[model samples]
Target: MSSRPKAKPHFRVSPAVLGPLGIEQLQDPALAVLELIKNSWDADAKRVKIVVDQRKAPGKILVNDDGHGMALAEFKERWLVIGASYKRALEKSEGGRPLIGEKGLGRLASFALGNTITIQSARESGRSFLADVNWEELSSAASLEEYEVKIRRGAVTNGTRVEIHDLKGAWSSDHTEFLVAHAEFLASVPGERFHISFKVDGKAYRVKHALATINRLAEGSLEMRVAPDGTPTIRKCVINGADEKRIVFRDMKSDELDPTLAGTRLSLKFFRRDEAARRLSGVLQRNEVTEVLERYQGIRVFRDGINVPPYGLNRDDWAGLEQQRTSTGGPTLVPGNSQLVGELHVSKRAQPHLVITAGRSGFADQAAVNALAKYVRWTVRALGTARRAEHLGISEANVRVPARIDEGKDRPRTASPQTIRAALTAISRSEVVRANPALRKKLEDASQAITETLGQSEESLRLYAQLASTGIAATSFSHELRAEFDVVSEAIAEVAASSRKPDKELIDLLSTSWGRILAFAALFKVVPVKIRRHRKTMSVSELRSSAETILGLASPDKVTTELTIPAMRLSIVPAEVDSILLNLVSNSVKAVAESTNRESGRIRVRFEAHGNDLAIHVADNGCGISRSVAQIMFEPLEGKFAEGTGMGLPIVRYIAERYKGAAAIVRPPASGFATEFVVTLRNVVQ
Candidate 1:
């Protein structure tokens, strides 16, 4: 029994063709970057410089390596073949190092980034060679076009160069800044002589080395990191200075170096561009670093320098993580799939279980790795959650000192940590706790005044805890707390004025401090935000005051403020009246704040009381709501300078209806102004 009849050639010879490919399909920039970097590695380059020039128009990505040059044959058949297998066959022969590039498809990566690609290589074997490919031609054809990439026999010395031009993606100021932000990864590699350069509009990329630079902008700051299974260390970092090499980690505390230091721990890296000349993780690209980061800014667990793959810090109980303050200093995992970042130092002797990767820089593909990844995700989730009750307390120490209020009432140009600290303090005090002595004293007296007012602080505290648990902020909470703080802090100042202390100057200074603190805290007041789960509050009196203020703004200036229910307060869900009030009043104020005639721009507010409802009427004598503004009052609209997001009246209407109310903008009364507003509330709350 022999095999079946001899196989015959097919009736016709079929043409073999390469499959379709697109540059846009390059999913992982890390993998694409590896392709460029690997060529240098293959050249046996001791030093390579990666430069990314993202100027105004089309950016150019250049990779130049001082490695061995390419020979003619290697350039044509081996270098240009898609999915070529030259490494396995040649490994036993020349050089004998394992090849970083096995599949030839890596060369295709340039297509994803740009349309024009050029490669230049020099060989000690002979002269340098240059090969270029225009991908537009490739992508334009219905079928694959084979272009022979041959080595140029002329010009330069031994080395390889690749430059991709005509960038597929447009460069924006944002993208340029992003590249700069990740610039730290540029010069980061230990025990290696590689340099990465980035330029935006011709300016060299740089990093603000001080950890304090981050502190300068955050409302709250905490710069701490944790390491795996070892003692941690902490070191003070002034905003723009460097630390004196006293190794610090979460596992090891104290500046004193332990001669017997062993095991894993978090290390705070202070960047010194002119000195260390090393990248934090010893990696050269942003994508490479991102590959190991958990959703949070924390890095993956590395056992002996190898990454613990799919799962990271989750499994290594002693894994590296940080608290979530302003910088990577604290542990915080925000929403969205962020870039992988941060470095966790490790060495060869870490436990076998810890070394999740199978000797490579990847994690071992086992259930443990999955568990670890999940653990990392869970830990990140816990930073703002599971640990809130505990972590919130610890983070209070990181609040920054507040800024001095300057004239003009404009907000600080930068996001100061003090701002966040003040907001937190006020929230915690009036809306959450009466820990502050002055606030505590008010609560003590409120209890003496009556039973109703005493429960307010407890209610604020209860609401605060609820917000903390759900990560939802209530708008009423801010107003309630602010008003309470304002009233209470004012009371404290009065009570303190009578104290004839041993030192009159010290007492006066304390009084000034109280006033400044109270005023600073009040500035935290913000426009209501009703994002999902967010609570926006507009109190009845606040609405009336704001509206009256705006209505009084007339060119002739006749708008004035008069409250009918001076002490009354109601909660409006959305802000129909608020929007109309803001638009009318602001217009009124603008028309009047610098008026020549209508002396005091007069705006009137009268609330007509009914059993369960009320009618609020506002009349202004300033420039009335223009037809243009009335038509689009709360709707976000695009126009010239200060063009409205148009959230005014629409938001007001939404709020009015939300709280069972109706708002209308009608033609104004005679002399003073040309605007009238009638807000009908179904049920007004006190």
Candidate 2:
């Protein structure tokens, strides 16, 4: 047998690969221009200008920068290379600016904007040269080496100029505005000396960073610094300018966080949109402030004072702030994305593991990125807690809730209802409270009420959990039961067809009874399962009709109900609104039935328009609630009535808060009613 000789083969690439590497690498023309500007920044350019000439068809774009330009040899070796980044060996430029381009394909981003690009460079001591490339020609070539770039010597200043011709799409005023906005953001990067200017059709556009103004007008802010070892400290926290306090979190370690997050700093500014508009009225209009917030609301990532793409954009929820806002038990605690703007600062020199994606869309999916997200979420939670404490005039120490309980075992246990009750008892009997008779009495009363409410809540939660489990089984059971019923129905029809008159009548009765039983089973199956609801726009008449139908099914025949709704449309989740009404009306009916002297029971549900908000007034003529009980009525399981589970009002309040509104007991109840509850749905009409 003969042995085969070994052969070596090399990889050859066609110019067609540039389609994905350059033309399709960036879908947006504005983003491609930004990439070119970043290259100028990396070159230590002190001044950069971008001109978009749209006065004629097939317009051209010119980007000029005064920086350290490349010579003929450097251009041929570095600029012509694809995917071989010279920046991989250099951490910073000669002028000490942090290098921004790493993929080496940023120059090719020009292909996304146009087919032809002409580049002219003039070095300080070397001969200036110009190179022209036609992407279409290169793309059609069989191999990368087949395409040629026209080169010529040039007598120009020390800088670089790029002219893109044969535009892919028409540049409109909207595109110019987009570039202008991006330029303002770029210029706003801290510690960056590079300046960028924009011109549309030879008209110079001024850039004003609105973020600076927003930062100044923010109502609440949190600034934190994390050490290399993962120890986080609050540098400054202004919850409310009127009264500020320092908040501290104890025993937190970076063990769970990625070590790459070391030395990361985060600063968040929160704005109550309406309040911010009022404060900025002298400087910016309400709509302008709104537009600014809408454009830049999420937390952005900045590495070495350079803005990263796709993080803070309107559509980006990289930090999951919007998700948290809609998560279970988060509506009241977490602020929506539109209410916040923040910056997460990392360094290329310090946190090297935080690598950017190849496409430059965002950071790579690694432990460091996940750790960054976790840290941001924790910071948001802390800021929210501090803000709430300040607003309520509560001490930061009192606001801290135990996350877990020490069970005197190998593993700590989550705090249970019993543990919370025991802790409340201990608090009421503390020495400080016991020393004062008045305070001691108040504390005892409060503790007792809280204990009772806790018990009721625990019981209700247990039952709801059981019901959810049962619902799963009931769904399957109902299907089978329906099939059996259908068989019985068919058998009855057969018997009626072959029997005498009396026997036929008996069979018909049995079928009707079987049908009623099947209907009951279907109703039973639905009772344990919660309906998933989606928000939809409905007219006033539609909403009214739906409410009436719900009331007819849920309300007692003995009680009279009246609904008054404004003649306007609303966007709401019908199921949520139904839940709110059912709970309120049920409570009122109970109150009326237990009244000492009442000829008739009446419940009035009136919807009133308060500016952009929708106020739902539920009033009833029933045994009135006392000032004391009414004060805590909306609290979970705070109802004092014997037959009440006390969870109804809390559920109502939760739904209201989910809509950025509140549920309150209206004191001095509405005329002709004994007790009144008002649930406001914020901005429902708008």
Candidate 3:
């Protein structure tokens, strides 16, 4: 009997896989072109040129590079194979250039911009190969073998050229401009790295490299280095004459007041509008300054001198500068994202787990990335604070008290602190010792009274600011108190019904609601605490319990509370401690109450010894404060939330300061908690 040979089984790929759908992975046409340029860069090409001719219905795009090209065997195995990565084998080129290509998908990006792609490459051996992919023809084929890629071998010079025609769509002038700009930015490295030039319809388009150095023009700067263990050391530098001098200040580590910063290096430069204007006056024209400010204004991430996507985009608020400035009413002096520019450098060796997302949209959404973003936002706010402080100093120096000293008519206004101090010295030396003595006595009494008044004025202003913040919070707290009472009233009705019916569950509910009412009542007690009259050494455990007690009383079973306080004591006023706990816990409880998520809400209080200070964290699994809101939330009457009086934080701040401590909002650990405010105070034993 004769038997036919059995058909052998093998993998088959449909031609449709190489059609337009194949290039869909690249979202933007400009990005497709960029991918090609990047490939040329990875190829160690010293000179790369891209030209676009769009005068016809279907334009022609050509990219030529002088780089060592591919051989026939390499082309068949790596070039034609999708996802083949030669970069994985050789991390660097023969010329020692770090390879930027991986995943082996960049070559396919050509299909995104054109229907037909033709490539001709020659290696150092003088052997050349030509290959072309007509996606339209490939789409008609049933399998990969149905349409064969024609290959020719010949002797040619060493280089590579890619020609794309039968364009998928019309390339607008905007696209051309973007290509030119993108080419300039991508090739912003030293000339030794690569030289990339662009042309449109034979007209050479040069990118005006007018990007101003933010450090050179910055009025204030903040440089910080975060260790792998999250320890952050920051320096606040102010631009003085011919040099930037580091300004000495305590409490620089408070980015939301964190004790440590992990895994990032942030350098920020802030230019007040006027300072920017002055610096750019000689280098850039008035219109150019405006344009530069508009073009570059946000914190951008750079990995090995190349910018990562999305961070520097106009809409990206990687740093919450704009909102903080707007909400705080310091638009002129408070540098927003538009008035600030800086870089956050991350290394693959350092941040090994910080991976980029597919299509380079942004970093992969994960805990590390979120923390990085939070820290960056904090850095921006810190720089803004520094700038505002400098501005205030300038304004104070320029302020004129207009004192007549010995009542010798109107004198010229002193424009500087030194001048005013000198005038005061002269008044005391010459005017005060006159025989008449009346003017001297008058000046002496007036100076003494003014000094006392100034001291009183400072205290009064602080009190007023605190009161205003408290009043705003009172509005919200009052509403919350009333709501709790409403629940209590409903519970009373339930209890009455239960009394008649003898139902245990209704009685329990009534009891729980009553406890909540008492908790809400306890909150009011802290509000009236105007002085630290009740001073004592309190245990961290005691502090947590007090806060938990208030929360338990106010909300009952509406939210769960956890306390992880260490066995530590701090010398402070019991009432002041109560205020801090009450404000933070109440805020946490309100946050959880507002969440629409059906999951149970939680508040966590933890305390630990941090160096010579005691650190307490009041965290909650609720809608967290945004970067912007957190910046100014401590300001009197600054918060815009429904249940927030904005007074709680101010009071907390006041109490912290009174005890030689600080209060700051920190990025919460990823325990599903949204808000974490940390209070750091001296670990004084009494």
Candidate 4:
């Protein structure tokens, strides 16, 4: 029978299979951006405008594209397809360039950050129409088939416009931050073929050219292109403002056989940022060319003349985002082994892949050329070289061995860290695995195992540690009180011995002394404490003396110790400091009990300033905690450590927190098992 051919097991993924992942599959607002841009690109719009206004609570965003427009039937067929368009169009070389929005999901990017989404489009066929979608309605609907839509005639003459209103998921501040990130992305769009403008709170956020910093810094030019046979080759390098003085570097030889110099490639080039300004602007303006041809900034790297992994040169105004506690913050330092360099593969599909996350995950799986992974290491070295040159104008050759780390990725070999970043970066990316078959299978398998627990675990650990530390502090306080009783008894004995003078004053002193002693003993018996008379902020000098007092009283012959405190103002209640001091002294005495040279076992305490932070270090020359031990020391369960209720450090940590600081067990004073406690406090006055 002419029955349908057996279905291949390959194309098995259904929408039901993709529906379960809420955040990973859909949370990236970046995808939505790709969608909006894709649609505009598909329309063949010469100019596209992106507007973001946080002043409107949920954020008012609109993307306008002046493209060839669409017909009513075409719009119904094309615009309505979600995740289906790319499935049909991915076979071609271009991802629907004359059209761009191949992956239907790009249109939903607006929904990533907000709820209500509005789309207005006009075509050459019937008439302009507007479609409003309240995503909240989708949840209660029985199925995710084509939604019920309210369509009305729109006023636009041509092209399409999308307005995302009443965005529900976030507030205005977050919207402003998103706009700043969007501006950075706009700078990288093909300037010759694409035009984009972004306005945030009335400020023009989009810059139509390369980064001014990169422009101001570009010093030279180099280009690489694939051979007719598809072999990548690097050609001539030109020194800018140096009269086109050329330097011919041979193509890098692949030493796949030899273990040393295996996959490593060293590329050192300098560019004047101004020289590359408007590299995107088609038909470069004469004035800009002249400006670029003159003096410029330092070094930068490019893959096929397009800058990738922006080596900290482009100040995208998101620097503030990289410093705070927000998940958004973290300096945009392209890590040495990171896979963020999606610019290396500059073929037709390459550049697009670098801009989206879906494309990135695929590139990280490649075995032939883990270029992004390789190039990151190079970038780090170049950064140090750049820093040294900026500070002292020294060539990188003068630095220590500049070598790459070997991660056994792709081909087994060594690569300087900078080159690793270069290797990991690429040029193109697609969301659907089918879009890039080479990466689809692996990425899909990995996506399934992703649980919410991975990222959330950091906070979980912090809470657990906080509780454990508090419990330890309470335990240590009890140990300290028990030890203090003997000292009180000895002090009274000394006073009684001096009362043998038999004078009138001695007789009266003896009578009151017993009463005061009884009262002192009663102080510990009751819940009352002389806390009001105890703690206050003290200088380094006072802290030093307290250390000595606690040590001298604990056990003078047990072990010798040293104290190093700089003359500076410090903020810590003296009572707290005293407690910390006494605990540290007692621990040091115990550490040396079994030492061969018991007299030589030593502990040292030092307080130093690091920028605005205060670091108080307590070090010992006894047995040290191993890495495995150190990792779990802060945990609730401690190893079988004698003389330790496992609470000494936890209490130290608690005291540090009350002072708004952190405490950790570090290296001791130059011996095995020597433990160091580090307390870091913020904003020390001096």
> For this target, which candidate reaches the highest TM-score against the unseen true structure?
2
User: What is the per-residue lDDT of model 1 for residues 1-686, given as tens digits with 9 covering 90 to 100?
Assistant: 88788888744211122223323334334334445665565556755655666654577877677778677678777766656757534432144332444445556667766778888876774577678777766545544434433345567576787888887765455445433333333223343344445454566665322233322221221123333432232323222232211322122224322222234433222221111111232334322322223122334344333233322222122221211111121122221112223344444334334332212235344444333333333323322221222222222334421211222456333223343333323333452234356744533333332222222332333343233223222211222122234333333333334442212222222332333233222222222233222334546556655444333223232444655654455544333344444443443444444334256666666766666676766665555555776665644321111212223344445556765777777764535656676767777645
TM-score for each of the candidates: 0.40, 0.57, 0.54, 0.42
Per-residue lDDT of candidate 3, residues 343-441 (tens digit): 787755456565666475566755565567667755665554445445434323234322112125553331233332333334434422344365455
Tens digits of per-residue lDDT for model 4 on 332-416?
A: 1111211011123333243333332243222222332334323323333333233323333233333432122211335332233
Candidate 4 root-mean-square deviation in Å: 25.6
Q: Give the Å error, residue 69, model 1.
A: 4.4
Regions of model 1 farther than 4 Å from truth = 1-22, 25-61, 76-78, 83-106, 140-145, 180-183, 206-342, 345-466, 470-686
lDDT of 4: 0.44
RMSD of each: 18.0, 24.6, 21.3, 25.6
* Cα lDDT listed for each candidate: 0.41, 0.66, 0.60, 0.44
TM-score of 2: 0.57
> Lowest-scoring 10 consecutive residues by lDDT in candidate 1?
321-330
Model 2, 422-461: lDDT tens digits are 5545544556555657655644554454344333332333
Ordered by lDDT, highest first, the candidates read 2, 3, 4, 1
Mark the 10 consecutive residues where model 3 has the least summed lDDT.
397-406
lDDT winner among the candidates?
Answer: 2
The whole-model C-alpha lDDT of candidate 1 against the native structure comes to 0.41
**Which has the better lDDT: candidate 2, or candidate 4?**
2
